[model samples]
Target: MSIAGVLILPQVIQRGDPGEVVHFFGIPIVLASYTSSVIPMIVVVWVQGHVERWLKRTLAASIENFTTPFLILLILPSATLMTIGPVTMAFSAGISGGVEWIFEASPWVAGAVMGGLWQVFVMFGLHWGLIPIMINDVATLGYSVMKAPVVASVIAQGAAALAVFFRLRRDHKIKQAALPSGIASLLAGITEPAVYGVNLPLKRPFIIACLSGAVGGAVTASGGSAADNLANPSLLSISAYLNHGNFVVFCLGVLISFLLAFFGTLFFGIPRSAREEEQPQELSEDLDSGIPAQPVPADKKVVDADAQVVPAGVVVPVAVDEGNTTDLVAAASGHAVPLSEIEDPVFSSGAMGQGLGIRPATGADGSSDAESPTGAHPGRIVAPISGKLTAAMNSGHAYGVRADTGVEVLVHVGIDTVQLDGREFTPHVTKGDTVTAGQVLVDVDLPTVTEAGYDPTVITIITNSDHFSTIEPRTGIDLAAGDLTVVVER
Candidate 1:
């Protein structure tokens, strides 16, 4: 799709008026514009995938790479320009026209339906059909009723997140995540974080917000409000969209959506299990006990899972044997937690791949001041799986290990502890080092890090998380310095 999109985009006709699109082969071949389209590209890509696979199997290997791309580029552009592109564009335009018809019949009903399910449409790639309608409405009628209800849905989600923020205590990590995610949606009109991280997780908030959005959309459309511009549905961009008649109605509807979702979540409350889960709790007793992190003496021996007593200095082979699943161990001895509790959006949002957080902190203050019980120093961060140290930061705050099975793992000690300038961190390994699971990679002075005002949660992430079918973080349970914490499947 990457290579094909670039090749096909430049040649797609920009002709909007029916008369301007001259017929191909003297037949009325409608060349629909592909600006901001989804369905067409999806269709093309689907076809291209099959086409590329067939090409690879049939073509001679000597010319396979060159011929495959060459053939795909040649076949897709013409098929798209003539058939698939026109048909999908027509289908999208047809959906748009049908929506316009509904608005014409009863704007209120149209608004209610679109507003309630706009997010669903966005999720399923079905909303691409509406883009042309909105563009056409603005150009021909100077306003787009189809565009009016969008903000209602957006605002509702934002309001729900805001409600979650208010519902959780100040010390709760979800509360912290909800606040920024809500602001991003309510102000900036970006709701992916809010929807995925906050609202959807709670379940009820999402349903409530959608219903509230319906009411808001109904009000906006019933009052004959329309959008004159195509822009993100956000508070900052609302002014540009409110130029049509009954603009006050649009604002009023938006306000209603916000208030409704907010109140609905507040009054209804989240699940009992959620409430209980949100309560402040400490990690395992092993971590709470003030055990110092200690390195094994060269003469000492640690027994492997296979029961082989290997000497401390003899680096065990980086473990890479696997089948359907790859299990990662706890790199830090503390309370195992979901990435969502890590206080870092990059980790919590599942954007950096699925992983877990080991909170060494005794309380919800999010400082990992505790290491573990074994009387061994808790500051030691070990390799969870046997892998080559692909990235060993000199600062000793982060390490990226690549398992021979092609799994990339990142072990980051503490949140924002890098600001401490490596003053309290000691690196035991460097880049390109092969390490066994349970081998100490870095030893940090947890107390010094916590006193320096940094979170001491040890974060472990699979950098290539998306490559697998599923990456499950088995958290919220007791784990030792090297216990199974995450499971990734292919």
Candidate 2:
């Protein structure tokens, strides 16, 4: 049908007049115009499938074969041309006309709106509404303008994923997932994985991709590009626009969409915290490798009065010290407040251990003292004691350090900040790294954290308070990094 429509049907239509009749074997056969039509052939084929099945079931074998061929060749085609074809064509025409009217009224606005909202529709599974309309437009008018801008939405999503892949080169786990998803979207136009799995989780990159898609959609609409076939927008489907004069403009719009989304996400979308959280799980998997296999000699082992000696069967060595007080310093430059004053119950009730919450000090420039010179918030988190980091969340929101004095401290950045998945924190060191007092542990963007609706109070807790005779927290005092905030006696 496609070949006949494109090659032979036009000439036949030009040679004949409407309502013309032809004869076969002295029998009159009225020719209802079907040249270059889309629905008639499809309806006939659809009807034939059902009709053949019925004929085979009801008729005997020898009779069924002969009757089925006659019924399909003569009756089905006539019924399709008389009923189904004309009705479907009219319906398709109405849809095409309505869409054309909208495009004609304001091409640029229509393009931008559609391009921006296409992904939103996809996210909610509402884009299915446009699929049939796009198909009808191609069937009735030989092209569809609606899909041209939608193509930008697909391309932009892929670009956002590619941007993250490039930005998070050190994050092996994230790179492993993102690289394949991005390539699939770019070459094959599959975008749901990139959108749902990668871009949406990061927030900013998804918005940037939408904005870039809007730009491409507007450009394509302004240049009057339309897809000539009902096919997905991809490099492989470029041939669908070959005969259309707007092919070059279509290609250019796609390129602009890709470049804009890729660069926009790379520069401003993904945060340091998100990138830092992409560390491979392998670091935490080899637990045995980090443990000491043998115990130290009795002469070298100094047990603290508070230390309990478990049988030597435990995999990891426990630190010990004589009865002495260890001062735990503040992790951030801020004024300390008692944990009871904090808004969250987990900290206020001392459920996450005994701690003091600090409200970060604001600088003269209206930025928090914890903010970096580059204007990123929660400037830095420093080690409060010279210790080995026993556990650190890849999200950079929390760290557990065990001092040689047998004091275990947990530096937690904020209340419920874990839900942000490390969008505003950057870790300077991973778990198992030896850190000294005042050494940078993580850099945080407090403004972004607050903007995400999380409290930016830094909490310093004596996690293993049971190992100490007394854990005293100092509150209502202005303190800097390394200043004594908690006193632990063992």
Candidate 3:
């Protein structure tokens, strides 16, 4: 026999970070380079999960909140001759080159402007615009003098976050998470947690942070020292400052920035907890008109026994009682819960029906039957839509339904709206009562709501609107009753 030929495999070796080495299949590998892109999203994910409730409300508000600013941003040119890449390169070279020139001519002014203006950019969430320049400086020039300002700026941001820790009288959990994140950013440059969680919550703290960042950046600029590499702004990388032979200057600059932000936040004032706290208020005149809001179970039955039935094509004209025919009376009048409180993305989007979203009768995670009970058990439960009671849930335990075509929909307002025991509501119809569109279902006291920190995001889900081929929502942008959602063939 020729005998089987035996071969030994060659080990392929790779490089890694500081003295850390590993053997993969007998191949020694070293990890040297780490990219920020490789940065784990865990921190962001953790922050969001912990503050899911606040974030959900913020997201809802953000959707319509940025309308004006978003519109303006849209009007700007989409294309620019000077691409961000080129602009960044030029800007970096200019800032660095210019600073060098300034240092030679008059370092004081240069420091002040750099320190102050850098903070201004950060306040608008525009700091990401400079990342390319920092990366390029390290790649092409072996160092990045442009990063000094940001290191200082982070210190300022941290200070602002700290202010919230002391000033907040409520929501201790939010403050606890924010304070550490802020301190972490000051020491390590991870500002997202601070920005999103704390400083931004208090308007004045945000402003104070910017001012402090600027002051700190100015000090760094005056030191005539610079960073040796473009690296993530974290305490782990402070050694980069040592390359400039002025580690002391860098430390001082960071310290000054923090003090300025902290003291400035204290002096300028962090908004009182009351300012950020949610309060319920009465609905304004804006809440009136268009969608005639009627309480459910209005007397005899939701459908009028003798009411005129129009043909498919004929318009079902709704008679208006200007006195009580306010379309879309505030849905969650005095007990609106944040849309995010539901946790179901589908429910939060309100895509299910007008504003009605189906969620856990209990809180997210199904904590307990007690803490999260909707009073109605799981599966196809009907709830009170507004404050007004039609017939006291005539079945003794449950109320009647709002059915159109072959479908039925359950209506409920607020989280524990029924708990109000119909305090702020007026019942228009009673059990087994017939009701026409535009009928006054209930009267809501909106003012009493905002003062209580309720969002009043009314929900009108089609609990059983599906039995019909399709229930088309009525025209007009306002999402209220009487807008005419047609039930037709799919």
Error of 2 at 431 (Å): 45
Positional deviation of residue 384's Cα in model 2 after best superposition, in angstroms: 43
Superposed model 3: Cα runs more than 4 Å off: 1-110, 117-129, 171-173, 272-490
> Candidate 3: global Cα-lDDT?
0.50
Per-residue lDDT tens digits for candidate 3, residues 219-337, read 77666656777666656777788877367877788888888888777656554554366677856676657458877764645767577576775566566443422222222212233
Instruction: Give every collision pair in model 2.
Output: 370-379, 377-444, 377-445, 377-446, 378-446
Instruction: Judging by TM-score, tell me the better candidate of 2 and 3.
Output: 2
Q: Give the TM-score of candidate 3.
A: 0.40
Among these predicted structures, which one has the highest lDDT?
Answer: 1
- Encode model 2's per-residue lDDT on 1-490: one tens digit a residue: 3322422355335433364554546654444445545544555567778988998998888798788777666665445534555566566677778889888888888888888889999889898868867866775578888988888878898898989988864546656667788878777888888888888887888999999999989877777888888777876777776675477887888889999999999988877775664455555567878776887796787668679656653334235354588877788877789999999887788876787988885333335544433343335688888899998997889999999888888998888888989886889999999999878899887767776778888888887777767787878776666766777777
Report the lDDT of model 2 for residue 142: 86
State every prediction's TM-score relative to the real structure.
0.48, 0.44, 0.40
Q: Considering lDDT, where higher is better, how would the candidates rank from best to worst? A: 1, 2, 3
lDDT of 2: 0.77
Local error of candidate 3 at 11, Å? 29
**Candidate 1: tens digits of C-alpha lDDT, residues 158-213:** 99998888775543767778989999998998988988888877788889989998
**C-alpha positional error of residue 471 in candidate 3 after TM-score superposition, expressed in Å:** 26
- Please estimate how well model 1 matches the true structure, expressed as its whole-model Cα lDDT: 0.79
Best by TM-score: 1
> How far in Å is the alpha carbon of 179 misplaced in model 1?
2.9
